[model samples]
Target chain A: MTMFTVLEGVAAPLLRENVDTDTVIRIERLVSLEKVDLGHWAFETLRYRKDGSDNPDFVLNQPRYRGARILLAGRNFGCGSSREGAVHAILGMGIRCVIAPSFGDIFFSNCFQNGVLPIVLPQAEIDKLAEEARESAAGGAFAVDLEAQEIRTPGQRTVSFATDPNRRRALLQGLDPIATTLQRDGDIESFQQRDRQARPWIYG
Target chain B: MPGQSLFDKIWDAHVIADLGSGTSLLHIDRHIMHDLGGGRGLRRLSELGHKLRNPELIFATPDHAISTEPGRTSETTPLSSGYMKVLREETKKHGVRLFELGEDGQGIVHVVGPEMGISLPGVTLVCGDSHTCTHGAVGAMAWGIGSSELVHVLATQTMVQAKPKRMRVSFSGRMHDWVRSKDLILYLIGRLGAAAGSGSAVEYAGPAIRALSMEARLSLCNLSIEMGARFGMIAPDDTTFEYLAGRPFAPEGRMWDRAVSHWRTLPSDPDAVFDREESIEVDAIAPQITWGTSPQDVIAVDGIIPDPASAANPSRRHEMELAQRYMGIEPGRPIAGTPVDRVFIGSCTNSRIEDLRDAAAVARGRQVAKNVTAWVVPGSYIVKCQGEAEGLDAVFRAAGFEWREPGCSQCVAANGDVVPPGQRCVSTSNRNFAGRQGPGSRTHLASPAMAAAAAVAGAITDIRQLA
Candidate 1:
């Protein structure tokens, strides 16, 4: 897992509400492509034309937003499916941070596991950032400082954010959750030992 | 201490340790996986050099990638063959049970879990698919997990989860005739918006909910994810017990009695207080259907398509306009009588025996409308067998509906059973998101009876009118 300390790069604004994981990475792309190869296929429907040519109208297809490492989105982004391929595709496309007003519960959790940072901010604040991204000549250069829990926008304004402290620590260190959880194997086994006796049917 | 909700009780029972910042290391009672992630998850665990901690608790089946075609083999869908083969090999190698194609327990993970008694009251279950919340109908703390989380569960039969606030959505009043559980849920999502249940573990209660059959309860809970809730539960009662009594994996004899007694105590106490409380009057909830991309973009079957100008904000109006353009639906026009190219009566949401029976009843002595293709894909092989034994398949077949084999056919469109581009489908599946059925495929989410009615009328018709 790659550590997410600070990310500084171009931000592409996809300001559509309820941008579901299905749209982030279609099920067909997920079934057909490897996780590492999903970048080009992210938002395939919106990114490509019927003739397989790039859709220049797409924000990511524009020269300014090319190779964007940050995504400015609307509420309930990644709202459908538990497909981790959605996060994988985003990461493959070089997006390390997503700023949304809200997120689908599972998609939000998946982002942390893949070293992608999903930040929840007020819709008003996101709208402001997206405005700057759209108007900035420097291609929406933004800095997301995980350690400081703040986002620095192109307009020289600093917007603070909040995240789970434990998750924050893990991301800072790039710790594998399984490895950390395994360190407490003693607790898990003891609980199971007692649980098995109390609920034998569940064990079966 | 305050009275605990059914969700809290089950969650508390599974807590192995409380990790700081409101998170807990919870023991997983059951971890269900499907072909889409099962093989990949196991392989990932091995790549990490981690052994399966509790193989016995894991259940794998090939549903997402396998074809629902008659006499379908693992190789039926060439795209899915590799996944199915990998799942078979990995489950075998890891000592995890695989319900292969044609097997009795083979079905959609959510459907098979409850039917096989793997999902029980007061248990914590997780699966790789979003609809895993369907198992919560059995009074379990069930939710979906991403691939990394799936691999984590594969390596350790537990998950580190943030404790979600409790919410109770009580369906008040008696359901009107022709209103199914699917309608009740769709109505709730449409009314509350898709993000209404975000960050909460929701419990469905009240007389209307208690009156539903176990399969209907499953149908209702299956759409929890669509409403932005990872977990949706209904407390265990006589209905739940009856459904689990003689299942293949349920407890037996004295164990069954003990299990029932325990399950009896799993419901919320009379004084139990939730973080949020909501109630819906079910008596007037007509059969609901979605006309736009999101499940929230829904209305009563008899209602007209919503005009984007009525939206609360510019963004919302823009979204509505985009959805209308993509769906090719004309605003201010009646949604009913809109012709459909296909009708799908299957998915974890409404592919149980009860759902099939409801659709079959509508299809009995009727013929499918010309130019409309309808498919009846059962949730599982057992559901298919049961439907066949009850002559439900014959009724559908006689009505010109194709009675296909089990698996999530045309639901996620991963199995090659997709609605063609630019086609409109009346689907019993949970999601109606753009391209959910296939690229450029417009989906109208509805109940089985409603879908059947649409198939017969060759348009979005109200099931009540047909009756």
Candidate 2:
């Protein structure tokens, strides 16, 4: 069974909106499928040099915000194309949860299937998280309790937000829509059998 | 649920049975298979020792990865050939209707369905491609399925699904000149932030929607997936009837009368409720072009690229920075006049005959910019033949754009036809994600005419200026 639980950890901030799948993993950094390295790809063009060294100018390389897990992002996160590879690259990079104001529709569903908790917070709460992440950029550690819906900053200030009940359950259970449907497989089978009798042409 | 709504009627009729815990075994009335993801389903069926259960309910076509390179026959594109072979093999084995390359009905599955009156209203349509929503323009309840589910559909003509909530996008006023359904949908996607359609199947209604031609309606629903909506639709009307009147698969003579009567009853009642609602004024919107990586990261032709620092939300700021750096554009730089190395005007998105005519109208007697390489591929072999017959190809060629063979070129870049790394391309196809065109390449989404105008101007220029 896939691991499904709330990711409670220091939120690492990669605050961006409309991040396309390609930037999450560049075509160059990828050799054949076997040489697939996840960390090297997450924001590869943004964080690394042509020679593959850490760009001191990159946000992740900053001393204060090291080892952050929760990616706090803007509205419509993971927008543009419907590349599943982007989801794979992010999940592989140890990003357990993403707190965004919004997510690209396909990407959000993909995250659920692949075991990424995408918490959609109100813009106001996301603003607070962004501010705290920015302010703690020097010290770099912030706490987010996914179960508590609270963000704990360096100075111990906590912020709370709301998430939808159904989504919360699905994320916590790691139950994708397909898996959820599979839970009622017997019922589905009975239904299909009845349907097949009615439309025998469809059942051959 | 009787007499509730067209949405409710279709939903309940198609739902074979309500499985416990909110799942349902859905009876698919129409199944469209394209080349991209459907081949994997064939492989799965092969491995499982399964033969298709209902081939008549299934229809297959070659689309994605089909090459548009002129003089390069189907033999050159191996991926497309492989996909086509599998599709052909399965269709023959199962007696499913196949729209092969030489078939008169061949085209983008979405385009072919409507033109042939195969995408009927009140049907549940399933396809392996996301843009199956395009079929929903005729009021069908359509959604894209994954490859595994596609196999299930192939084997049973039914797949298990959970119902999605419904949304209504209302547009009340008559659209202005030069702003077609393509622009309206693009503007809505830009305004609603692309993901607004998430968790919902959108029913597009209102005066503006009722005013669109069947082709225009198809264009609107085509990009529904681009905005996170599983499907987008408009209710059937006289326009739908008029378009389907003489099509090959449409109801004939006496059956036509009954079909029109049924199609007339396809719209939702006044009291039908939607889980969400979005309203947009058609007049206020302008031609859109994607600037950043995401389709939502768009600005009007007259607008500037958004600055990360100007963003109030921190996550937005970070995304802006990443988009800016990758796109190689400065903050606050106007999208118009941004240098474009290439301009592509094709794909399932805008490769229809009407779209080509629109672009050709703009390119007539005009020359492409010295620096820009432009391609104008049709959506099908039929379109290509018709274009050549009508001398539209000559118009494009005269304008210095290569009039290509039909395929899904430069849209997903699934084939080898891609822009070189780091170059910026103004494409008429949907999705402008970074590296979408190629590794390190940038894509700018626009209307077909806008792509033509940009090809001429060598940058992102408003088609209105040329008009």
Candidate 1 — which residues are off by over 4 angstroms?
Answer: A33-36
The DockQ values of the predictions, listed in order, are: 0.80, 0.20
Residue-by-residue lDDT tens digits, candidate 2, A20-127: 556676533332324577775788877778787989876667765555567887666775444455667777766767888777665665565566777787777777
lDDT of each: 0.92, 0.74
- Considering just the first chain, candidate 2 attains a TM-score of 0.77
Candidate 1 lDDT, tens digit per residue, B114-187?
Answer: 99999989889999988988999999999999999999998889999999988999998988889999999999
Best by lDDT: 1
- Global Cα lDDT for candidate 1: 0.92
CA shift of A41, model 2, Å: 5.1
Q: Could you give candidate 1's per-residue lDDT for residues A1-204 as a string of tens digits? A: 679999999988999999999999999988973444898899988899999999999889999999999999988999989999999999989999999988999999999999999999999898899889989986767999999999998899999999999999999999989999999999999999998899999888
